[model samples]
Target: MKLIFGIGLFLSLSLLCYAQEIYKESMSLMGSDFEITVVSENEQAGAQYIQIAVDEIKRIEKLISSWDQSSQTSEINRNAGIKPIIVDRELYNLIERSIAISKITDGAFDITYASMDKLWKFDGSMTSLPTPEEVSQSVARVGYEKITLNEDEQSVFLKQPQMKIGFGAIGKGYAADKAKEKLMQLGVKGGIINASGDLTVWGSQPSGKAWQVAITNPMDKNHAFTKLPIMHGAVVTSGNYEKRITLEGKTFTHIIDPRTGYPSQGILSVTIFSEKGELADALATSVFVMGIETGIDRINQLPNVECIIVDDSGKIFTSKNIRINNNEN
Candidate 1:
């Protein structure tokens, strides 16, 4: 029910490539742990840049957080069936993009999933599986197709009274991307904005090497199975290893399929690589919900995007473009 292992899902395995000091600051933001790191020998400048990143993340949280009744997202949810809620262009664009992603994933990734009531618990509170009828009712109010958006007014409205939306699946990655963009705009050469596990990287290490990302074994998270370099890009890993419940001797992951209203199965972890953290974050969850073959097929069709899937049996699967052992950076 809680978070991380979302993007920077794999243990962040950035190697210290240069002698330049790596200054990092950690904070809890948007109900998740966030670590912002920048490479610079000047301690003062690094601290300032980190603070700037922190501020940007906080700004994003206030704009999109559903937990805060004052946020635009909450407003949209409150006015779900009553009237269209006008929102800032930034949020409108974000929701538009989210819907686009929903179309691509065929409802595997949905923001309207927030309408689902707490039916399954992973904290040992859930001992029995929800009946199929209960599962169906849980997702009755959740559907991307039910969302109505007016481009002219830049407004959002839910078709159902109980319908709601949230960015928990993609918010961290969006925050990471925005923070990285702001830092880069300020002329920060190289650094990492890791929102929980949703991570974005740019520039080069002090040694002039591209940033490298390592994939963790679903069986053994501490041991990375493969490492790939992603410079000026983002990588997000969504794993069911940490949040799951076993009922009737069947293990169910926390990633529930909004379309089916059942917990996701078959895959233990999904890691997506793309130029944007927002897309990576959404795709990771989508692929996890889509299962192995379909997820790999979907990722194969997308350009400049790749994914790694670990199934329940601990089998490793990667997209066509990914070279398992060879260095592709």
Candidate 2:
């Protein structure tokens, strides 16, 4: 009777493990749910790895987060235009990358957008369009060139007094990348790090199948546009569907173009596929602001980078090598 009972328990456990389901856990960290999903594995080990990933992500939040009043990034902001503050190596590297991207994009991607005055409100309170003068002045302090970086000392300085830098565009991606690294180091066979909508995945399904991720339709949130098979890389999406303001019959998106000091218009959503989550995250925002034509050109110039763009009229455009799996289930 004891042997029979043990065999029955083992069979029950095997049945439970074979069920096709999304094994997920949510942790309150990095100002949101640091979500992890594994195809099928040891549940205890998965949960432990996710917890460790969340801890690492929150550490990044503390390092690069600008919204947090007590973060080290705040120290840099406080010292802007007054003194240069030496930052951690990680943040120093991220800031350096941001500046480099900004230059590469000709200031289209800027971290100094915090200096813009609250000229355009998308919170359903905007009544009229910002005047030309207001738009020009808003971007006056928004120049990546003014951001000074010292490589040897690992320091950052803002030339203007009111200038400030925020990682809102790339923080989530950075966290996701860091979390992915930690999980890989811990010997996780299969896992995903999803920081909000920015996500990176690795390994394969238990049955040795590639992991597939669905791209949601911005116009119809209930539906997916396509499912992309991801083996070991990252994907990031920037969309204007959730945040927009209508002023004087003109619709403005939440994605602000730093060079023009106005919200980006035309494109509805932009998705970037890259080997590095941080680059994918920042590029998604940059390309969304750059619009379809220029965006595709820019992405094509970069190696191992691809993009999919949906315009306001629902027209879809993709880079040369992007393959869309349209099996909607």
Candidate 3:
């Protein structure tokens, strides 16, 4: 008999309503549901594999969660500005990659954005815009260049006294990448690890079909505007609609522009597809802050990275290989 065999007819008939031979499990992690799925000849086997992947994802989240206050990442943050603190290999690499993207985007994508003070409230309580000095002071602590990385010692340092770093934006993608890696290491041929909306997948369905993913319409969250195929990589979407606070007559998204110390405007959503989830996650926010023209230009320069951008007017733009297949036609 094969190591994994197809479901018997009796078992298949019991769960006939399921459209695909897929098994899925949803777990709570990183403040959202982390879902994993495996498609195989047998639903039972697929469920077992998905559980394994979800377990590994939960394990990683516990280690790296900054919100936990007891996690390794939080420890590094607590010691910030005092001395260089060594971190795990995973966090060290993540910081390295984030700095590289920050350099490439001219500081538009910065992990040190946490250094900004909790000023410029966007709740519907303010009547006047913040003064230029207030804006400047808020971002005085948010320069990625001030973050020193000692590669030989694998330590990270924030030069300013009040400076801090957080991984709220890129943590999901890193978790997705780790989950996918763990599943593949377990000898699973194909699966998807979705950390919130940051997801990665590889191989083919047991039926040899491509994995399909839909891009949401920013104006209408209920409907998907496009469906794209995922052969062997990752996809991540960031939207201004998700987190926002309104003040007076204006609405400010939670995504801060590191340069201005204010919320970004114009773009509504950004979706990135790349070979690595980490790059896709970081690039999605970077492109949103950079706006369309510069965003497209930056993504075009990177290897194995593609982006789909929706502006405030709902205008859609895409990179070379990203096809926005409107399901209407």
Best by lDDT: 1
* Candidate 2: C-alpha RMSD after superposition: 4.8
Native-to-model Cα distance after best TM-score fit, residue 52 in candidate 3, in Å: 2.8
Global Cα RMSD, each model: 9.9, 4.8, 4.8
What are the lDDT figures for the candidates, one per model?
Answer: 0.88, 0.83, 0.81
The ten-residue window of minimal lDDT in model 3 covers 1-10
Q: What digit string (tens of lDDT, one per residue) describes model 3 on residues 1-329? A: 34234556546654543344767777877788778877655777777787777677677777777677877777767877788888887778888888888999999999888878776554655667777798899798898898898989998888888787887777778878887887788777677888776779887676667888888899899998878778799989999886777666778887789888888999999999899887888889999889899999999999889998888887888887776565222
Better of 1 and 2 by TM-score: 1
Q: What TM-score number comes out for model 3?
A: 0.86
Residue-wise C-alpha lDDT for candidate 2, range 20-93, written one tens digit per residue = 34467876676766678765456676667778887888789888877788877888888889998888888899
List the candidate 3 regions with Cα displacement exceeding 4 Å: 1-20, 40-47, 120-131, 323-329
Ten contiguous residues minimizing lDDT sum, candidate 2 = 320-329
* Candidate 1 residue-wise lDDT, 1-329, digit = tens: 22565434333433323446678988999888888889875789899999999999999999999999999999999998899999999999999999999999999999999999888888999978888898889889999999998999999999999899999998989999999999899988899988777789998777778778778777888888887776788989998999877788887878999999888888888989999999999999999888899999999999999988888888778899876762221
Stretches of model 1 off by over 4 angstroms after superposition: 1-20, 326-329
Error of 3 at 90 (Å): 2.2
**Model 3: how far is 316 from its true place, Å?**
1.2
Candidates in order, TM-scores: namely 0.91, 0.89, 0.86
